[model samples]
Target chain A: MSRTRVHNFTISLDGFATGEGLSAEQPFGHAGHRLHQWMMATAFGAPIMGLPGGSSGVDNAFAQQHEPGIGAEIMGSRKFGPPGWQDDPNWRGWWGPNPPFHTPTYVLTSRPRSPLEMEGGTTFHFLDAPGAEALKIAQEAASGKDVRIGGGPTMLRDFLAAGLIDHLHVVQVPVLLGRGVRLWDGLEGLEQQYQVETVSTPSGVTHFTFSR
Target chain B: MSRTRVHNFTISLDGFATGEGLSAEQPFGHAGHRLHQWMMATAFGAPIMGLPGGSSGVDNAFAQQHEPGIGAEIMGSRKFGPPGWQDDPNWRGWWGPNPPFHTPTYVLTSRPRSPLEMEGGTTFHFLDAPGAEALKIAQEAASGKDVRIGGGPTMLRDFLAAGLIDHLHVVQVPVLLGRGVRLWDGLEGLEQQYQVETVSTPSGVTHFTFSR
Candidate 1:
C-alpha cells in the first residue's frame, strides 16, 4: 500500500539523528558520518555513487535493503545546502547532475524557484507550500508507490509530530557524537507502538520497521 | 577530576541492542543482556530513563560537555546476565552487603553467582577469569580514586572503544539463564591506539583504564 515511510534514518547514541550546524563541509557530524559507514560499504552504496567492484558480504546484503521502492522523495531546503534562493540559477540540486534518488523530488522551502530538472529522471521541485501540502504533492507524484521522507531532522520532526507518517524505519549506528541535533527532541505527546518486523545485519546497522 | 560523560552507544533501531532469542524471557535478547543499555542510561542517560522528573534539557547539557575526574564504584553479577560457564561455588565477588565503592566499579565473571566481601569493602567474583582478569586487579583500588568499568556493554565498549575508560566498573547482576554468552564479538578489530592501565574498585569490582 502507498504510505509515508522515513527509511534508513540514522541516529547517534546521544539521541541525535543528525548533528547541529550542518553544512556541506560536514554533511553529517564527525561521528555522524560513521552512522552511514555500513551503508557506504555496501554494494548498493558503491554502484549508486558510481564505485567500481564493490565488496559484497553481510554488509552488502544489508545495503541492498536500503533502496525502498521509492516512488517519490521529499527533502528540506537546508539539506540542499547553499543557503538563500539561487539568483544566478546554476544550482543543480544537491547530488550533482546524477542524483541517487531517480524519482520525482519535492523540496520544502520558503523561497520560490523553478523546478530543477536533472539526469536519471530526477526533478527537484521547490514547494513554497507548507510541509503538509508538499507531502500531498509528493504522495500524488508517487503514483501508488511509497513516498520517501528524506530529511534534515527538522523536516522529519515536523511530519512526525503532525502525524502524517504511516511508517518509520530507523537505522541506529553505533557511534557517539558528544554534541549534535537530536532526533527524539520535540517529539513529545505522540503515543505510538511499533513492533520490530525484522533484525538482520551485524555491521552495527540495525533497521527497525514501524507502522502506525 | 571526576566527571560524568554521556556515551551514546548505538543499538539497532529494532529495539534489540543485541540480537534476539534470549532465554528465560530476558528482555534484551538471548545473552544480549551483556550489551549494557541500562548502564549507559544510568551513567549517561539519566534523563531518558525517566529519572524522576528528568529533563531532556539537563541530559543534553551533560551530553555536550566532557565528564572529568571520576573515582570508583561497584558491579554485580546480575548485571552481566548469563555467562557461558557452568555454575560453581566459592566464587563470591560482586558488590557486597553495603559495598564500599562509592567511587566506581568493575566486575569479573565466568558464571552467575552471589556477592563478595572484603575488609572495609566487598568482593563478588565469578569464574570467568582470563577474559575479565587483568581488569579485575588494578591499582585504582589502592589509590581510592580513578574510574570504574561496568560489566555490561556500557562499561566495556564505551570505555574500550571511546578510549575514555581508566578502570573497569563491572557489575555482574545475578540472573540465571542459558545461551548467548559472547562478550566481545564484532569488536575484534577496533584499531585502538591506547595503553592499558590497571585499577580496581573497592567492592571487588576490577578496573582497567586505557590511556592514549
Candidate 2:
C-alpha cells in the first residue's frame, strides 16, 4: 500500500506555509528563510548552510524524516518554480543540477511542460491533475513505497481537504507571517481523522505529526 | 509601571482561540473545553472542576501565572458575555455569583453599562474605551500591580497588535477547529519583539511564552 505523506512542512504561527509574493529572487518572499531557519540548523538541513554537521536533537530527528522510503513527490507549481518559470524555457528549478528530491517528482501545474531529467535519479514530470487524480499518478509512480506531498500551503490544503494525505508533519515556527497562503484554512476538524502528536525542541519549533 | 499580560490563553492547532458562533449556552462555542482541557487537568485549573489535587506539572505552573501579578483584569465584551449581552440588563455575567475573577474586571464594550458588583470582590465594569485607553483605566484600577488582558481572540489580537502586552502565554492544544476566530491574525513579526520559549508536557499541549 503506497501512502501519501507531508514531512518537515514549516509554517508560521499564523499558518502561512511560505510568505507572500514568492519569486526566484526570494522563493519565500518576505519570509526569506524564517520558516526554515530552524530546520537549516538541523543535521538534515545543514546542507543548506554548506556545513558538515548540524544539531542531532529532536529537530534534526524530525527534519531527517523528509527522505526515508519516499519513492516519488507531488508538488504544486508554486513550489516547482517561482511565479513564471513556465515563461523561461531555460529555467531549471530553484535547486541546482543535483536537486534534493532524488525521485520521480511530479510538478502539478496548469500548463504542463516536458519531462526534465536531472542527476541523482530525479526526473521532473509536469501534470495538470487535481488532488485525487494527482495522488493516483504519484502513488503509481511511487510503486509501493510512498508519495510525499511537497507544498505551497494552497496545494497542501487542497490535498488535506480532499482527504488524500495519510501522514502530515507540520513544523510550527514561532514567527508570524501575518500574510500569505494559509495551510489550515479549509482544514477545519481535519484533526478528528488522524492521531496527532506534538513535540517541542529546544529551538522553539513545535513538530506536529498526524497519522491516519 | 504596571505591565499588561496574557496568560493561560489556550488556542487550537489551527490558531482558533475560540470556536465560531460563541453564545451563552455554548460559551467556548463548538470548541467546548477541548482547548482548555489540558489546563483543567492542572493544579490551578482543578478548582474549576470543584477538585483539589491536580497534575502539578508545567501546565499547572503556567496556569498559575494567571493570578500572582494581576490586580485588575481588562477583557473585551466578547469575553465578558455572549453576543447581544447588552440587551439583557439582568445578565451579570457568564460566571456564577462568585466569578473566577476576584478583582476589578473591565469589560470593553461600545454600550457601557453600570458596574455589576458580584460576590468575592469581582466587579464587572463596562467601558467603551479602546485598547490603550481601556488599558489606562485598567492600570489605574490595578493601582500598581499588573493588569491581565483577558481575551476572546479579537480583544487579545488588538492588544497584541497595539504592542501593549508585556508577556504573552499561549497554550497550543492538539485539537483543530476548522473555522473560528483566529488568535494570530495581523500579528506579523511578533516573534522578534519577544524572547520566546516553548515546552511540551505529557498532556499533549504545548505552551508558548513570549516575554518582552
Candidate 3:
C-alpha cells in the first residue's frame, strides 16, 4: 500500500530535530550537523560527503529505507534551503545539481515559485498550502509508490498532529541540543495513534519507528 | 570510590520527568503512573506493587540497579510528596511505613523540618542546601558508598547543570507528556561530558546511561 512516511529523521536528546538561526552559511544553525551525524555516517547518506567506508549496521539499514518505494517527497522550504530561499531566485539548493532525493520533491513555503528540476530525478515544487493538500498532491505525484514527509520538525509535527503520517522513522542522537525546533511539541499522547518501536545500535543512536 | 548516580529515572519522549499538578491524590499528576509503569512491571520495582510474574529481561536488569550500591539518596521535595507536604505533619511519604530507600534520604526543600524515621532504615531529612552542599551531606551520610540522586526533573537538572552527577540512568518512556517538569532543561551540551550508552529493551522503553 502507498503510505506517507519519514525515514532516518534525526533529533537530539532534548527533542530538537533542527537547530535555531538557520542561514545560508549554516543550514542547520548552532546544531551544525550534529543531529544528523549518525545518518550522515550511514552507507546511504555517507556517499553525499564522498566518504568511502561507512557502517552498514542498523543505522545504514534504516537510512537505506529512505529512498526505496518513495516516489515523491514533501519537505519544508527550510529543508530545501536556508531562510529567505524564496527571496533568492538564484538559490538552487544546499545539495548542488544532483540532490540525494531523486524523487518528485515538493517544498512547502508561503511564497509559491516555479519548479526547479535538478540533474537527478529530484524536482523542487513550491507549494503554498496546508499539509493535507500538499500530501494529496505528493501522493498523486508518487504514482502508486509512497509519499515521503521529509522534515525540519515544524512540517513533521504539523503532519503528525494532523494525523497524516503512516510510517515514521526518527533517530535519537545522544547529543542534547538545548534550543531548536522540537518534534514532540504538540504531539501529546502520540503513542495512542501509532505503535512505537525502539532499537539502540552499538554506535549510540536509538532508532524510533512509529507506524499507525 | 563514592559515585553519585541516578537510576530508573523515567521521562517521556519530550523529556518531562513528571507531569503537572502533583499532589497526594495523584503524585505524578496527569501523568499518573504511566511514566513509571515500565519500572513497575520490572522484577525490582514490581515487588512494591505486590505483583508477581514480571519480566526478567533488560528492563528488570536495569531496574535492579536502583538500590544496589547506594548508601544514601537525595531526592527533591516533589518526589517526597505533594506540595505543602511540610504543612501536613501527618504526611510521612507515599511509600507507607517501609519506604524503599533503606538509607539516609535527604529531601531538598526550602522549608526544613525535623527528621522523620520510618519502619525501615529510611529516614527523611529535610535540607535547604543547594545541590553541592546537599551532595556533601549525602556523601558523608553515604560512608564511602555511592549516593543516588533521586529526582523530579527540576532538582535533577540543577544537579546535572551543577556537574554534581557522576552516573545517570534515564529511561525514555514512549508517552508524550506535553506539559510538565523537563529533565533536559538547562542541560545543553550534556553529551560532551558523559560517555553515553543507549539500550532499548523488549518492553518498549529506551534506557539512556551517561557516565562521566
What CA RMSD would you report for each candidate?
Answer: 14.5, 1.4, 1.1
lDDT over C-alpha atoms for residue A190 of model 2: 89
lDDT of 1: 0.52
Winner by TM-score: 3
Which residue ranges in model 2 land beyond 4 Å of their true spot? Answer: B51-53
By DockQ, the better pick of 1 and 3 is 3
Provide TM-scores for the models: 0.55, 0.97, 0.98
Residues B1-212, candidate 3: write the lDDT tens digits: 89999999999988898888887799988999999899889888778988887888899999999988899999999989898888998888889999999999999999989999998899999999989999999999999999999997899999999899999999998889998889997778988998999999888989999998
Q: What's the alpha carbon RMSD for model 2? A: 1.4
The count of residue-pair clashes in candidate 3 stands at 0
Q: By TM-score, how accurate is candidate 1?
A: 0.55
Clashing pairs in 2: A188-B178
Over A140-211, each residue of candidate 2 has an lDDT whose tens digit, in order, gives 888899999999889998998888999999999888898888888877788889998888888988999999
Positional deviation of residue A53's Cα in model 3 after best superposition, in angstroms: 2.3
Q: Which candidate do you rate higher for TM-score, 1 or 2? A: 2
* Fraction of true interface contacts that also occur in model 1: 0.00
CAPRI quality band, candidate 2: high
**Model 3, C-alpha of A35: deviation from truth (Å):** 1.3
Which residues of candidate 3, in runs, are more than 4 Å off? Answer: none
